[model samples]
Target: MASIAIAQTQQAQATTSAPSAAAAAAPAMQLEPTSVIVLDSGGGSIKAGWAHDSQPTIMGNCITRPRSARRTFVGNELDQWGDLSGLYYGYPTQKGFIVNWELQNKIWDHVLSSSVLEVNNFAETSLVLTEPLFNFPAIQSAMREVAFEEHGFQSLLHTTAPELSAYQQRVDSPSAQEAQVVVDSGFSSTYVVPFVQGQMLPSCATRIDVGGKVLTNYLKDVLSYRQINLMEETHVVNEMKEKACYVATDLQHELEKAKQRPSSNTISVDYVLPDYTTIMKGFVRAPVARTGPANMSSDEQLVKLNNERFSVPELLFHPSDVGIKQTGIPELIGLVVESLEEAAQYYAYQNVVLTGGNARFSGFQARM
Candidate 1:
């Protein structure tokens, strides 16, 4: 868990003379929570909305150019495209860090100026932006320039995602302990962070290279080798991973079940691939008894999944399987706790928090 700190910076105007009596009598302006925009910028998606909203609006963080279309789509515009095959994607961030400001500036322009966020005036709105832990100084500087100079925001408060998570935990459970450990498994990597009494310990934090993007790419490779050649279909394969994959509590037992015949294998299932005509997105075709002749009228494509479902997600627990030489999330969390003080270790272990997109896996909590 990381500590949350809100520090707003505003530009000061240079005045040569004293203020007028009428100006001095007027009250100073203040930013309300409803007028502030909260943006959680991630490698895979951007979670943005007003501070007063109950939920954040999620938008894809990458720009895509479809093979069928000549023009490119930015952020949420990809949803309007019907054909999703062979989309060449351009990302503003790489490995969880902002490197391409040119592309990111475009995304920000679209997000702030377009109807997505409905920001009427950038100069009047204060922004609460989140960046990754140990972010580059150059990137941070660029972000400040973008917010104040490029977008002309009235004020900006920079923070990290884990910090916000810790703050939310305190708000939700005020009677809970003071120490917390946050495991943020996102697109580029996973981070294990510790916070004690609302203060983050940067030295004790650890990171793993495995994340949702690696798992999705691994699944694509396995599917391509076993089924049709889907090397270019990243968009489709990502959806497949979300719809079909899950963590396994008993890895060896599940592997054994997958080894059985298809008729008797309980772990095996058929994932119907999208044809972009009848089915816009793929679905898991329910297992049916083959007691009669097969229906010849339907021409749907399918990929048979057995061990790949659980094996892909297993990389989070064992990055060694993919030759990453780093410890998994569980070991990483333990290492962070061991590095902390004895008094904080107990509370950190007791109040562990799991966040990010990967935490939504079907059996993730059970596996943990």
Candidate 2:
């Protein structure tokens, strides 16, 4: 949390510093028509900031009850806790949709009122929040009431996450100069929304019921069945997946290599579980030669991994691997575009952009 604050401070250091001769000589900066406070929250995370900023300040969007900590932690406060074993999480959204506004409102209050964001007067800022592609009418109505009557914002522009991603795609992909297909696979689900000149085509947008949570759970089940039981270690399992999992370009070929003779396999690795007394967190350790227990170099327990690494992430491309009938990530995008006008389809196909946390998985774009 301190690091995040420091980073944001550093980002504005130049503008906040004493005015120089160059600064005095330069023309006064002009504000946008709307002094927008862009906030986008999902089931598990929140990305928010002033519209003028280059990037957003992201923080956990859920409240958690960890066995190690006595008091419940909410939002960024979760980062301050230690010994996060056996954490049972409570979220505002279920199955990618917000189901509990009380929790949602509490989190939003923390976000808007906390010193982290420092928005003095909500009435002075134009609020822009991102909603799910298929938002419930009740959720939408409640959100507007909170934004206007409760918080008293000057203005509000509530929309979908894909719309924000698509706008960002335009800014980042200057060469594209056309419509785009935004592939956002976050914690709860995957959404495919097309943007034509920064406007979303809601009629053609589609969503897939798969995401990081499902992927992680699927991986855990496979590992538990074949390697070890991790059913009670959700916290550790999630960390292991983030630190070690990667989307492989060649699924069948990699699986074959994984099953080959030990010397011929490149995918196999040893993940060193952290010794809480010395090291606070677990990590993927460099390959160590397997030997008797007495001959081990470190006390950290090492778990041998092979096919699990490649097979888990493969679920995104082949949901059928987990018996999910939904289409793959790329196929979902193709499904949305094929419904568009003939001319628009070409631009949408060429300018596809992936967003959300799962998009960070290595070789994900390559697989797409």
Candidate 3:
């Protein structure tokens, strides 16, 4: 997911450094480093920073109440927590829309507080916040109200994540200046959003209910059924998915290889789960060349993983595998592009940018 997000920025950088005809037409003017805060609040995390100056401060976007820790982790505070096992999660957003202002306000306070950003006041700076595609009108205005009425920001620009991504790509290159398609695989849901010349084409936007959180939950269920019950260990499960999962370029071929001789198959790996006593983190080790049953270290527990690794990530491409009955990511993206005029379709295809956490999976770019 981090790789894909960085790729999008790099794509923009290449164009920004050497402006093409379309990009040259409207050059970006330099502004004060702290003039505008480009805030991207996704279902899974928040990415916020001063535009054109620094990288965004990233933090988990949800609230957690851990049984062991017995303390509430609001937003980025979870990063400081030690044990995350058997934690109850509280989401401020439902289906990609912010529904709980009270809880979310707590996070915004932390983000904007003097101890964090050192911003004494927001009235002097403009706030640019990214909202989900096809946002509810009430939620949309409510965000603006909070920024102005609650936070006292001088100005507010409420835009969608896909639009910001498209605009960023467009400002650097002429490729994204026309109709461009953006696929944001976020925590709450994946969205197929179209933008024309930096403006969102709401008519061409679509949503897929599957997302990172869903995939993590699904993996937890499958692993519990097939191996161990990791249903309540969300933090550990999420970490496992991030480290072990990858989208398969050829699903059938990979599945077949996993069934073949275990010694030579490339689809197999051994994940060492943390004991939380001697070892604090889990990691995958390179396959050992063995002639018989695998050997385990006395002090460590190793879980042999095969198809489950790719199969979980494959849910993004084939939601039907889990009975969601939706078109795959690429097919859905193609459909959205085909809906545009023939001329725009070419531009849309050429400038399709993938953003959000799910895009970081290995072979994700190749599969799409």
TM-score of each predicted structure versus truth: 0.89, 0.85, 0.89
TM-score of 2: 0.85
For candidate 1, list the clashing residue pairs, or say none.
1-182, 1-193
Ranking by TM-score: 1, 3, 2
Worst 10 residues of 2 by lDDT: 1-10
Q: Judged by TM-score relative to the true structure, which candidate is superior, 2 or 3?
A: 3
lDDT of each residue in 1-368, candidate 1, tens digit only:
33321111100110001011013212212456566787778898887777666566678888999998999999988888898889998999989999888898888777776557888888888777778999989988988999999778877766777766765565455532478887888899998888888677888898999988999899989888887888899988888898888899898999999888666888777787887877888887544322222632267787877788899999999999989999988788889989988988777877777788888777776665
The numbered model that scores best in lDDT is 1
RMSD of 2: 7.6
- In model 2, which regions exceed 4 Å deviation? 1-35, 174-177, 290-298
The residue-by-residue lDDT of candidate 2 on 106-132, one tens digit each, is: 888888876467778777776767788
* Whole-structure CA lDDT of model 3: 0.74
Candidate 3 regions with alpha-carbon error over 4 angstroms: 1-31, 287-296
The runs of at least 3 residues in candidate 1 whose Cα sits more than 4 Å from the true structure, single-residue gaps closed, are 1-30, 175-177, 287-297
> Which ten contiguous residues of candidate 3 have the minimum total lDDT?
12-21
